[model samples]
Target: MQDKDLPDIVDLVREMGAFGDGGRNRSPGNSNSGYGQGGEPQAKPAPGLPAQSQAAPDLPGHLEGLAARARTYVEAASSPNTRRAYAADWTHFTSWCRRQGLAPLPADPQVVGLYVTALAAGAADNAPGRAAPRSGGRKPHAVSTIERRLSALAWNYSQRGLTLDRKDRHIATVMAGIRNRHASPPRQKEALLPDDLIAMLETLDRGALRGLRDRAMLLIGFAGALRRSEIVGLDCGRDQTEDGRGWIEVLDGGLLVTLRGKTGWREVEIGRGSSDATCPVMALQTWLSLARIAHGPLFRRVTGHGKKVGSDRLNDQEIARLVKRAALAAGVRGDLPEGRRADLFAGHSLRAGLASSAEVEERHVQKQLGHASAEMTRKYQRRRDRFRINLTKAAGL
Candidate 1:
């Protein structure tokens, strides 16, 4: 009806309500977009649906829901050592910044340059909470270490929505200067030779549980080229871990360990040794039987009682300590000062031992070590075929 229908039309519409609206056409752009008119009773919104549009989900609240699943992804993205290093690096930087009365968030590039100058000059050795100046004659970090610390800074800044431009002249120029000023060959950890490993094994008496466990750990770590973390992360079954790295299995020919290292999952085979005394599998089996460990972490702590084993897994550091103990007991590096000798042995010695001693192709060694590249594996091959590729011989000099 037209607007001129006036009071009578309004009275009629008001009295009749919208009963006639079902036959009328609604505008295309209207929210309902229903076939019928304005006030026709709609079907119960396809059952269990609201008549009006429900309030939209909170955008930020939806994001909050992702935090738990996102944390799982974040934790898996980097190794534990990497996370620990990142924290330490950040702490060092922030501590230094506090000593200098500087704002750490929006870091001043000049301050960063000064920080590197201090680090290169061995300022880290001084007493804490004291401002240290750059000095020329002091121990400095390896080039690799300095660069990694810088990366940690950049990463932390990124997490806080701030950009730490490492390419900025402040960082790059100072870093280059530090590299040149403190230039030195990389110092690698000492590798345990096969004879040395044998001697270390002899140090552990086969009669005791701790000795049996250590023997197994040393052999398995060396044979499998496992890192300290991987050594302690093994389980009896596949995918049976909250943070456990991988699993172990016994086969007819050898023992198979599927390990997740820095390079991801890879298999390591430790063939049956000639004798039970040196065999990794046999030693491991002895420990397993004695400790009564089944279907959980391969290595764990034993009580002071020496025979009683705890459910708690061994710490990664314990591997290093065990190596140090074995090395000392075996007198493998007697010529060096006691401190220097102690410093020489660590968990890495096992991995390096396999690399240096294995009479196999570089590729095989690389695979066993879980190194992504042969070049990386070569770094750990201390004193191995050093002059094998003499250019003079190749050139017929």
Candidate 2:
């Protein structure tokens, strides 16, 4: 039925005495007719509806509570890092809107299109009252970053029960134009091979508490192909902390790491290396023994001149810094300038290092990396045997 017909239908129902109070029992000037005995107007029944149909006083508050809970659930649906990025993106967009003297809400497609255009032109970088852009003066944002910001805006609108039509011509056409004009090739981190890893390891002071912890982290991260967050978020055992993302167990055979990653729960097996100096399992055990770390986060802060360990968990950014420092110290990429070499290595270098070095089958590598598809694992294999299949020759040239 058409929505416009609803009010007419209700009026008809009321006229037909569907409510079973046909007014036949009332007098010509009864109080039920919305008039007092003193001939003054009394409170009228709700228009075209019975008085019993009125909503309870608390119903609005109850619905608001449900809405608040729904918002909480939506926030919980994303990882903490994702939520944080989205929040920052929204704040940036809103700050830009303020500078432009526009409303951020109700999501006008034209305004959004203009906003993205400014991002592409680098105008948004210098928008007044906003913090200086991370890249310094007037550098346009990456296409990936622009796309993420758009997603953040859409999600923010949805949380407020508003619709943002990303498919609208204003948004879609501008985004397409931006992509055509500004998209660049993805920059992958330099993969650290086994030799390079050994060299980096050699740069550390093995006797120091910090050195042992860092050594264990690097080895475990490489062997397990673990992301930086997963490296530091791990506990000595399962269910140790509310924020812990995974845990590890030391066994006679190897080190078993159970992690809750983007793809959910998975186990990584890092077997004992050929030598005690290089074994990931041995390094972890040594670090644990020296640090007296029986529980809580596997990696932690080394305080008091690198002699004492702190109870707090280590930050993920430290992984990147450590990798860079060690890479520079070991002169892994001596051909490049010091600044360029430092920029090439990061936490992901360890994961990519293992992927590029493992001589096993593709499926084994994929499984070990906890990648749902072989294609994803291959992306991490920076130095894979590309010509192994010889598909061109096999096709009968």
Candidate 3:
């Protein structure tokens, strides 16, 4: 075709939205007849000139980079458990935002405030086949849970270099007001007494291997103030010995019981390597040696054939179930003066039991329990104190 007959590449590029500099199609020249009417070839546009069309910006790449940086900041600022929790919390927040017709980026403070209110109100329905009410429905959430979600959001925003002002402050104040107004009246934790503990321990019939394992598990759990995950992840060979004189080095000090908490495993000193000092650690060692658990999960599921099968670590729910079963077996049932039913015991009861037993130094109790602060320890101690107070009142104190 003649040069004059050829289509304009510039016009084609513009139509195709290739206007950006360095953004040009790489196709070769036209393959039409070489000879033109005037025998002149068409000149191409200067290489420096941008193609008419511009591809969309690298939005996905930008977002991925942002996510990586945010992850790094979260890792530095908090424990792995906290990071995981915050990630989940933020996911909920973003899901809520999508439902509210807001983009995940550039979260408006007003919208954030509304989200906080919604969270506190528990107005967002997650049930299947039930549409969330636009105005009002469902009971409000506990103040503490709401506050935790808000804190997670604020931390997420701060990590992204966003400013948190009146909206955040308003939410904070609302949470504080809720806290102050209710003051929660100090609810008592359901704990097991010494006799109850013994009953639960003894309920595990020592005739069978699984029975012996369960008994050992309950005893060590109560003795060491172990969280469910910690109990399940206990390394019999490394964490403790046949004599119970080893250490339990968790990942993140004792604040979290996840695998990520093992920041090179911070060891907790127990009994002497070889001595008659009766320590709980020693008890753990004896339990391990007797159990003959050389490797795999400290707690195992019993099979139909009565074989102890090695398995992955048990989750928190399994631990709770174990505790509940043991509680039922022990036949210890009665509501305390606080009105809390005796059936409410779970794995956490073991930790609370240890804390309650430590009636001497509160700080020592907190340390043993791996609580971040004494206030948390005090919360655990409140029920015992209330029981004591009631007894004193009954005695005419």
Q: Compared to the true structure, candidate 1 yields what TM-score?
A: 0.79
Off by over 4 Å in 1: 1-65, 123-142, 393-397
lDDT of 1 by residue, 1-397 (tens): 1111011122222223333333333232232211123223223221111112222222233444454455455556777677668766866776666555554645567777877877886775455454444565356667778888888877655543357777789988999888887778887889998899999999997888888899999999988889999999999888776878889999999899998877777899889899887889998999999989887888989887797888878999999999999999999989988989998999999999999999988999988888888889989999899898899989999
Q: What residue pairs are clashing in model 2?
A: none
Give Cα distance to truth, residue 229, candidate 2, Å.
0.6
* Model 3, CA-based lDDT: 0.54
List, residue by residue over 7-90, the lDDT tens digit for candidate 2: 122222233343344223333243122223332323343111112222222223334555455544544466667766776676
Error of 1 at 289 (Å): 0.9
> Candidate 1 clashing pairs?
none
Which is the better candidate, 1 or 2, if ranked by lDDT?
2
The candidate with the higher lDDT, 2 or 3, is: 2
What is the C-alpha local distance difference test score of candidate 1?
Answer: 0.74
lDDT of each: 0.74, 0.78, 0.54
Task: Please rank every candidate by lDDT, starting with the best.
Answer: 2, 1, 3
Query: Taking the tens digit of each residue's C-alpha lDDT, what string does model 3 give over 60-165?
Result: 3334555455544534445445666775676677667656655444435676676766666565544433445656566666666666777776666554435556
- Candidate 2 lDDT score at position 140: 80
Task: Report lDDT (Cα) of residue 326, candidate 1.
Answer: 92
